[model samples]
Target: MQQGSVDAFGAPVSADTLKRYSGGAITVNSTQAITGTVSNDSASQVVTGNNAITGDAFSSASGLPSVIQNSGNNVLIQNGVIVNVEMKP
Candidate 1:
Protein backbone atom coordinates (compact mmCIF):
# COMPACT_ATOMS: atom_id res chain seq x y z
CA MET A 1 0.00 0.00 0.00
CA GLN A 2 1.10 3.56 -0.63
CA GLN A 3 0.22 6.95 0.63
CA GLY A 4 -2.84 8.45 -1.03
CA SER A 5 -3.07 5.26 -3.08
CA VAL A 6 -6.22 3.22 -3.48
CA ASP A 7 -6.37 -0.53 -3.08
CA ALA A 8 -7.89 -3.18 -5.36
CA PHE A 9 -10.99 -2.59 -3.27
CA GLY A 10 -10.83 1.09 -4.24
CA ALA A 11 -10.19 2.15 -0.65
CA PRO A 12 -7.36 4.47 0.20
CA VAL A 13 -4.19 2.70 1.25
CA SER A 14 -4.20 5.03 4.21
CA ALA A 15 -7.81 4.58 5.12
CA ASP A 16 -9.97 1.66 6.11
CA THR A 17 -12.89 4.05 6.42
CA LEU A 18 -13.25 7.76 5.77
CA LYS A 19 -16.37 9.82 6.05
CA ARG A 20 -15.83 13.04 4.18
CA TYR A 21 -16.10 16.57 5.52
CA SER A 22 -19.23 18.33 4.39
CA GLY A 23 -18.65 21.87 5.69
CA GLY A 24 -15.07 22.50 4.65
CA ALA A 25 -13.93 22.09 8.27
CA ILE A 26 -12.73 19.22 10.42
CA THR A 27 -15.03 18.04 13.18
CA VAL A 28 -16.07 14.96 15.12
CA ASN A 29 -19.55 14.64 13.73
CA SER A 30 -20.39 11.25 12.31
CA THR A 31 -23.27 9.13 13.56
CA GLN A 32 -22.27 5.67 12.41
CA ALA A 33 -20.55 2.67 13.96
CA ILE A 34 -16.95 2.36 12.81
CA THR A 35 -15.03 -0.93 12.98
CA GLY A 36 -12.28 0.44 10.74
CA THR A 37 -10.02 3.45 10.38
CA VAL A 38 -11.73 6.80 9.92
CA SER A 39 -9.93 9.90 8.71
CA ASN A 40 -11.28 13.09 7.21
CA ASP A 41 -10.09 16.62 7.30
CA SER A 42 -12.56 19.49 7.16
CA ALA A 43 -15.23 16.99 8.13
CA SER A 44 -16.97 16.11 11.35
CA GLN A 45 -17.27 12.65 12.89
CA VAL A 46 -19.86 12.40 15.63
CA VAL A 47 -19.98 9.04 17.30
CA THR A 48 -23.53 8.20 18.31
CA GLY A 49 -22.74 4.78 19.69
CA ASN A 50 -20.75 3.39 22.60
CA ASN A 51 -17.96 1.62 20.80
CA ALA A 52 -14.23 2.18 21.16
CA ILE A 53 -13.48 3.09 17.52
CA THR A 54 -10.07 3.26 15.92
CA GLY A 55 -8.80 6.03 13.71
CA ASP A 56 -6.96 6.07 10.39
CA ALA A 57 -3.83 8.02 9.66
CA PHE A 58 -5.30 11.34 10.82
CA SER A 59 -3.47 14.47 10.00
CA SER A 60 -3.01 18.00 11.31
CA ALA A 61 -4.11 17.30 14.84
CA SER A 62 -4.79 20.99 14.74
CA GLY A 63 -8.08 20.06 13.12
CA LEU A 64 -8.91 16.90 15.03
CA PRO A 65 -10.28 15.96 18.40
CA SER A 66 -8.21 15.80 21.55
CA VAL A 67 -9.00 12.28 22.77
CA ILE A 68 -9.95 9.37 20.50
CA GLN A 69 -10.84 5.83 21.50
CA ASN A 70 -10.11 2.53 19.79
CA SER A 71 -10.87 -1.01 20.77
CA GLY A 72 -7.72 -3.10 20.23
CA ASN A 73 -5.12 -1.72 17.86
CA ASN A 74 -2.28 0.67 18.01
CA VAL A 75 -2.86 3.83 16.00
CA LEU A 76 -0.30 4.68 13.35
CA ILE A 77 0.99 8.02 12.08
CA GLN A 78 2.91 9.38 9.11
CA ASN A 79 4.39 12.73 8.14
CA GLY A 80 3.54 13.93 11.64
CA VAL A 81 0.04 12.68 10.88
CA ILE A 82 -1.98 9.50 10.95
CA VAL A 83 -2.36 7.83 7.52
CA ASN A 84 -2.67 4.05 7.51
CA VAL A 85 -4.47 2.11 10.25
CA GLU A 86 -6.76 -0.66 11.45
CA MET A 87 -9.95 -1.03 13.49
CA LYS A 88 -10.64 -2.05 17.08
CA PRO A 89 -12.08 -5.41 18.07
Candidate 2:
Protein backbone atom coordinates (compact mmCIF):
# COMPACT_ATOMS: atom_id res chain seq x y z
CA MET A 1 0.00 0.00 0.00
CA GLN A 2 2.82 2.36 0.91
CA GLN A 3 6.58 2.47 1.19
CA GLY A 4 8.56 0.75 3.94
CA SER A 5 5.59 -1.33 4.95
CA VAL A 6 6.38 -4.60 6.57
CA ASP A 7 4.08 -7.57 6.03
CA ALA A 8 3.92 -11.17 7.00
CA PHE A 9 2.51 -13.77 4.63
CA GLY A 10 1.69 -17.21 5.84
CA ALA A 11 0.41 -18.15 2.38
CA PRO A 12 0.70 -16.89 -1.18
CA VAL A 13 -0.19 -13.50 -2.58
CA SER A 14 -3.31 -13.76 -4.71
CA ALA A 15 -4.00 -10.05 -5.09
CA ASP A 16 -2.40 -6.94 -6.58
CA THR A 17 0.80 -7.05 -4.60
CA LEU A 18 2.81 -3.85 -4.55
CA LYS A 19 5.64 -3.01 -2.14
CA ARG A 20 7.78 0.08 -1.78
CA TYR A 21 11.19 0.43 -0.21
CA SER A 22 11.83 3.90 1.12
CA GLY A 23 14.31 3.52 3.92
CA GLY A 24 17.27 1.35 3.02
CA ALA A 25 16.32 -2.02 1.57
CA ILE A 26 14.23 -5.13 2.04
CA THR A 27 16.12 -8.27 2.70
CA VAL A 28 14.30 -11.41 1.64
CA ASN A 29 16.24 -14.19 3.20
CA SER A 30 13.52 -16.72 3.74
CA THR A 31 13.06 -20.42 3.10
CA GLN A 32 9.40 -20.25 2.18
CA ALA A 33 7.48 -20.03 -1.08
CA ILE A 34 6.48 -16.53 -2.22
CA THR A 35 3.83 -16.99 -4.87
CA GLY A 36 3.08 -13.51 -6.13
CA THR A 37 4.42 -10.29 -7.58
CA VAL A 38 7.44 -8.90 -5.71
CA SER A 39 8.73 -5.35 -6.10
CA ASN A 40 10.56 -2.62 -4.09
CA ASP A 41 11.41 0.65 -6.65
CA SER A 42 12.93 3.02 -4.14
CA ALA A 43 15.67 1.09 -2.41
CA SER A 44 17.41 -2.28 -2.70
CA GLN A 45 16.22 -5.90 -2.33
CA VAL A 46 18.61 -8.50 -1.08
CA VAL A 47 17.24 -11.79 -2.28
CA THR A 48 19.04 -14.67 -0.70
CA GLY A 49 16.51 -17.40 -0.83
CA ASN A 50 17.46 -21.01 -0.55
CA ASN A 51 13.88 -22.24 -0.92
CA ALA A 52 11.96 -19.05 -1.51
CA ILE A 53 9.75 -18.98 -4.57
CA THR A 54 7.92 -16.39 -6.66
CA GLY A 55 4.87 -16.41 -8.93
CA ASP A 56 5.20 -13.95 -11.87
CA ALA A 57 6.28 -10.46 -13.08
CA PHE A 58 9.99 -11.16 -13.01
CA SER A 59 12.53 -10.06 -15.61
CA SER A 60 16.00 -11.42 -16.29
CA ALA A 61 17.86 -8.29 -17.44
CA SER A 62 15.97 -6.09 -14.98
CA GLY A 63 18.56 -6.51 -12.23
CA LEU A 64 16.27 -8.96 -10.46
CA PRO A 65 17.15 -12.27 -9.03
CA SER A 66 17.55 -14.46 -12.10
CA VAL A 67 17.76 -17.55 -10.01
CA ILE A 68 14.43 -17.13 -8.22
CA GLN A 69 12.90 -20.45 -7.34
CA ASN A 70 9.38 -19.19 -8.02
CA SER A 71 7.77 -17.01 -10.72
CA GLY A 72 6.13 -13.97 -9.12
CA ASN A 73 7.96 -10.69 -9.41
CA ASN A 74 9.53 -5.05 -9.34
CA VAL A 75 10.42 -1.87 -8.79
CA LEU A 76 12.46 0.65 -10.88
CA ILE A 77 15.84 -0.82 -10.10
CA GLN A 78 18.46 1.93 -9.92
CA ASN A 79 21.99 1.15 -11.03
CA GLY A 80 21.28 -2.52 -10.62
CA VAL A 81 19.77 -1.70 -7.23
CA ILE A 82 16.18 -2.81 -6.72
CA VAL A 83 13.76 -0.39 -5.11
CA ASN A 84 9.99 -0.89 -5.10
CA VAL A 85 8.39 -3.97 -6.70
CA GLU A 86 4.96 -5.28 -7.70
CA MET A 87 4.44 -9.00 -7.61
CA LYS A 88 1.26 -11.03 -8.29
CA PRO A 89 0.05 -14.41 -9.50
Candidate 3:
Protein backbone atom coordinates (compact mmCIF):
# COMPACT_ATOMS: atom_id res chain seq x y z
CA MET A 1 0.00 0.00 0.00
CA GLN A 2 1.78 3.08 -1.18
CA GLN A 3 -0.88 5.19 0.50
CA GLY A 4 0.32 4.07 3.91
CA SER A 5 -2.34 1.45 4.16
CA VAL A 6 -2.39 -2.35 4.37
CA ASP A 7 -4.72 -4.47 2.30
CA ALA A 8 -4.78 -8.11 1.34
CA PHE A 9 -5.58 -7.81 -2.35
CA GLY A 10 -3.84 -4.48 -2.62
CA ALA A 11 -0.65 -5.91 -1.21
CA PRO A 12 2.10 -7.01 -3.55
CA VAL A 13 2.92 -10.67 -4.13
CA SER A 14 6.40 -12.03 -4.64
CA ALA A 15 6.50 -14.79 -7.24
CA ASP A 16 9.53 -16.57 -8.61
CA THR A 17 8.27 -19.18 -11.07
CA LEU A 18 5.43 -18.74 -13.51
CA LYS A 19 3.79 -22.12 -13.93
CA ARG A 20 4.59 -23.37 -10.44
CA TYR A 21 3.80 -20.05 -8.81
CA SER A 22 0.75 -18.73 -10.60
CA GLY A 23 -1.23 -18.85 -7.39
CA GLY A 24 1.35 -16.90 -5.42
CA ALA A 25 3.91 -19.63 -5.95
CA ILE A 26 2.25 -22.65 -4.42
CA THR A 27 4.31 -25.79 -4.08
CA VAL A 28 2.01 -28.05 -6.03
CA ASN A 29 2.81 -31.43 -7.42
CA SER A 30 3.26 -32.10 -11.11
CA THR A 31 -0.08 -33.90 -11.41
CA GLN A 32 -2.31 -31.39 -9.71
CA ALA A 33 -3.95 -29.74 -12.69
CA ILE A 34 -1.90 -26.55 -12.62
CA THR A 35 -2.34 -23.42 -14.71
CA GLY A 36 -0.82 -19.93 -14.67
CA THR A 37 -0.33 -16.70 -16.63
CA VAL A 38 2.83 -14.66 -16.92
CA SER A 39 3.11 -11.18 -18.42
CA ASN A 40 6.30 -10.30 -20.18
CA ASP A 41 5.43 -6.64 -20.37
CA SER A 42 2.64 -4.05 -20.45
CA ALA A 43 1.51 -4.81 -24.00
CA SER A 44 2.35 -8.48 -24.31
CA GLN A 45 1.76 -11.56 -22.16
CA VAL A 46 2.50 -15.27 -21.98
CA VAL A 47 -0.52 -17.49 -21.39
CA THR A 48 0.30 -20.96 -20.08
CA GLY A 49 -2.08 -23.81 -19.44
CA ASN A 50 -1.58 -27.21 -17.83
CA ASN A 51 -5.00 -28.57 -16.98
CA ALA A 52 -3.67 -32.04 -16.30
CA ILE A 53 -0.21 -31.28 -14.82
CA THR A 54 0.21 -35.01 -14.97
CA GLY A 55 3.97 -35.04 -15.16
CA ASP A 56 3.59 -33.18 -18.42
CA ALA A 57 4.46 -29.70 -19.52
CA PHE A 58 1.63 -27.44 -20.54
CA SER A 59 1.46 -24.62 -23.09
CA SER A 60 3.20 -21.32 -22.34
CA ALA A 61 1.88 -17.98 -23.56
CA SER A 62 3.96 -15.65 -25.68
CA GLY A 63 3.50 -12.14 -27.16
CA LEU A 64 0.09 -11.16 -25.74
CA PRO A 65 0.16 -7.49 -26.54
CA SER A 66 -3.20 -5.95 -27.33
CA VAL A 67 -2.10 -2.31 -27.49
CA ILE A 68 1.17 -0.50 -27.69
CA GLN A 69 1.86 0.77 -24.17
CA ASN A 70 4.55 1.05 -21.51
CA SER A 71 7.91 2.62 -22.12
CA GLY A 72 9.91 -0.34 -20.85
CA ASN A 73 9.45 -3.98 -20.10
CA ASN A 74 6.35 -4.54 -17.95
CA VAL A 75 5.16 -7.98 -16.88
CA LEU A 76 1.67 -9.01 -15.72
CA ILE A 77 0.16 -12.43 -15.13
CA GLN A 78 -3.48 -13.49 -14.88
CA ASN A 79 -5.06 -16.94 -14.78
CA GLY A 80 -1.89 -18.87 -15.40
CA VAL A 81 -1.25 -16.87 -18.57
CA ILE A 82 0.39 -13.65 -19.61
CA VAL A 83 -2.35 -11.18 -20.48
CA ASN A 84 -0.10 -8.30 -21.53
CA VAL A 85 3.55 -7.57 -22.23
CA GLU A 86 5.69 -4.71 -23.54
CA MET A 87 9.25 -4.61 -24.72
CA LYS A 88 11.79 -2.17 -23.40
CA PRO A 89 12.61 0.75 -25.61
Candidate 4:
Protein backbone atom coordinates (compact mmCIF):
# COMPACT_ATOMS: atom_id res chain seq x y z
CA MET A 1 0.00 0.00 0.00
CA GLN A 2 0.98 3.65 -0.36
CA GLN A 3 0.41 6.91 1.44
CA GLY A 4 -2.81 8.77 0.58
CA SER A 5 -5.77 10.61 1.97
CA VAL A 6 -9.30 9.55 2.79
CA ASP A 7 -11.92 12.25 3.11
CA ALA A 8 -15.31 12.09 4.71
CA PHE A 9 -17.69 14.71 3.33
CA GLY A 10 -14.73 16.90 2.46
CA ALA A 11 -13.46 16.58 6.02
CA PRO A 12 -10.27 14.77 7.00
CA VAL A 13 -10.77 11.16 8.05
CA SER A 14 -9.55 10.06 11.46
CA ALA A 15 -6.35 8.07 11.92
CA ASP A 16 -8.22 5.25 13.62
CA THR A 17 -10.64 5.00 10.73
CA LEU A 18 -7.81 4.89 8.23
CA LYS A 19 -6.24 1.99 10.08
CA ARG A 20 -9.45 0.00 9.81
CA TYR A 21 -9.86 0.81 6.14
CA SER A 22 -6.33 -0.27 5.28
CA GLY A 23 -6.47 -3.55 7.11
CA GLY A 24 -5.67 -6.92 5.54
CA ALA A 25 -7.93 -9.08 3.42
CA ILE A 26 -6.22 -12.45 3.93
CA THR A 27 -2.46 -12.69 3.42
CA VAL A 28 -0.99 -9.23 2.80
CA ASN A 29 -1.85 -6.09 4.76
CA SER A 30 -1.38 -2.45 3.99
CA THR A 31 1.68 -0.96 5.66
CA GLN A 32 0.56 2.62 5.98
CA ALA A 33 -2.67 4.56 5.64
CA ILE A 34 -2.38 8.28 6.20
CA THR A 35 -5.32 10.35 7.38
CA GLY A 36 -5.69 13.60 5.50
CA THR A 37 -7.66 15.46 2.87
CA VAL A 38 -6.99 16.91 -0.55
CA SER A 39 -7.34 20.56 -1.34
CA ASN A 40 -10.67 21.88 -2.55
CA ASP A 41 -9.03 22.95 -5.81
CA SER A 42 -7.77 19.45 -6.57
CA ALA A 43 -8.69 18.31 -10.05
CA SER A 44 -8.08 14.59 -9.71
CA GLN A 45 -6.96 12.00 -7.20
CA VAL A 46 -5.70 8.49 -7.78
CA VAL A 47 -6.02 5.61 -5.34
CA THR A 48 -3.95 2.44 -5.72
CA GLY A 49 -4.13 -0.87 -3.84
CA ASN A 50 -6.77 -2.16 -1.44
CA ASN A 51 -9.45 0.32 -0.30
CA ALA A 52 -12.45 0.09 1.94
CA ILE A 53 -15.47 2.35 2.36
CA THR A 54 -17.07 2.16 5.72
CA GLY A 55 -20.62 3.12 6.59
CA ASP A 56 -21.07 6.59 8.08
CA ALA A 57 -23.93 8.94 8.72
CA PHE A 58 -24.14 11.88 6.36
CA SER A 59 -24.91 15.43 7.34
CA SER A 60 -25.26 18.52 5.22
CA ALA A 61 -22.53 21.09 5.63
CA SER A 62 -23.35 24.73 4.95
CA GLY A 63 -26.60 23.50 3.43
CA LEU A 64 -24.68 22.06 0.46
CA PRO A 65 -24.62 18.54 -0.90
CA SER A 66 -21.83 15.98 -0.71
CA VAL A 67 -20.56 13.80 -3.54
CA ILE A 68 -18.58 10.57 -3.77
CA GLN A 69 -17.13 9.32 -7.03
CA ASN A 70 -15.37 6.15 -8.15
CA SER A 71 -14.06 5.45 -11.59
CA GLY A 72 -12.53 2.34 -13.22
CA ASN A 73 -12.83 0.29 -10.05
CA ASN A 74 -15.19 -1.86 -8.07
CA VAL A 75 -17.32 -0.33 -5.27
CA LEU A 76 -18.31 -3.07 -2.93
CA ILE A 77 -21.08 -2.98 -0.34
CA GLN A 78 -20.08 -5.90 1.79
CA ASN A 79 -21.59 -7.12 5.09
CA GLY A 80 -25.08 -7.03 3.66
CA VAL A 81 -25.72 -3.37 4.40
CA ILE A 82 -26.96 -0.68 2.06
CA VAL A 83 -26.73 2.94 3.07
CA ASN A 84 -28.97 5.39 1.26
CA VAL A 85 -26.37 8.04 0.53
CA GLU A 86 -27.27 10.92 -1.73
CA MET A 87 -24.64 12.47 -3.92
CA LYS A 88 -26.62 15.55 -4.80
CA PRO A 89 -27.86 18.57 -2.97
Q: Which candidate is the best by lDDT?
A: 4
lDDT of 4 by residue, 1-89 (tens): 22453454455556677767663444533354444544444334656454454455343245444454444333432232233333221
TM-scores for the candidates: 0.13, 0.13, 0.14, 0.18
Global Cα lDDT for candidate 2: 0.42
- Candidate structures ordered by lDDT, highest first: 4, 1, 2, 3
Instruction: Please give the distance, in angstroms, between residue 70's alpha carbon in candidate 4 and its true position after superposition.
Output: 41
Which residue pairs show backbone clashes in model 4?
none
lDDT of 1 at 62: 62
Angstrom error at residue 82, model 3: 6.8
Residue 22 displacement in candidate 3 (angstroms): 29
Give candidate 1's error at residue 26 in angstroms. 36
Candidate 3 lDDT tens digits, 25-56: 34544433345556543545745443333333
lDDT of 1 at 80: 30
Q: For model 3, give the RMSD to the true fold.
A: 21.0
By TM-score, highest first, what's the ranking?
Answer: 4, 3, 1, 2
Count clashes in each candidate, considering only residues at least 3 apart in sequence or on different chains. 13, 27, 20, 0
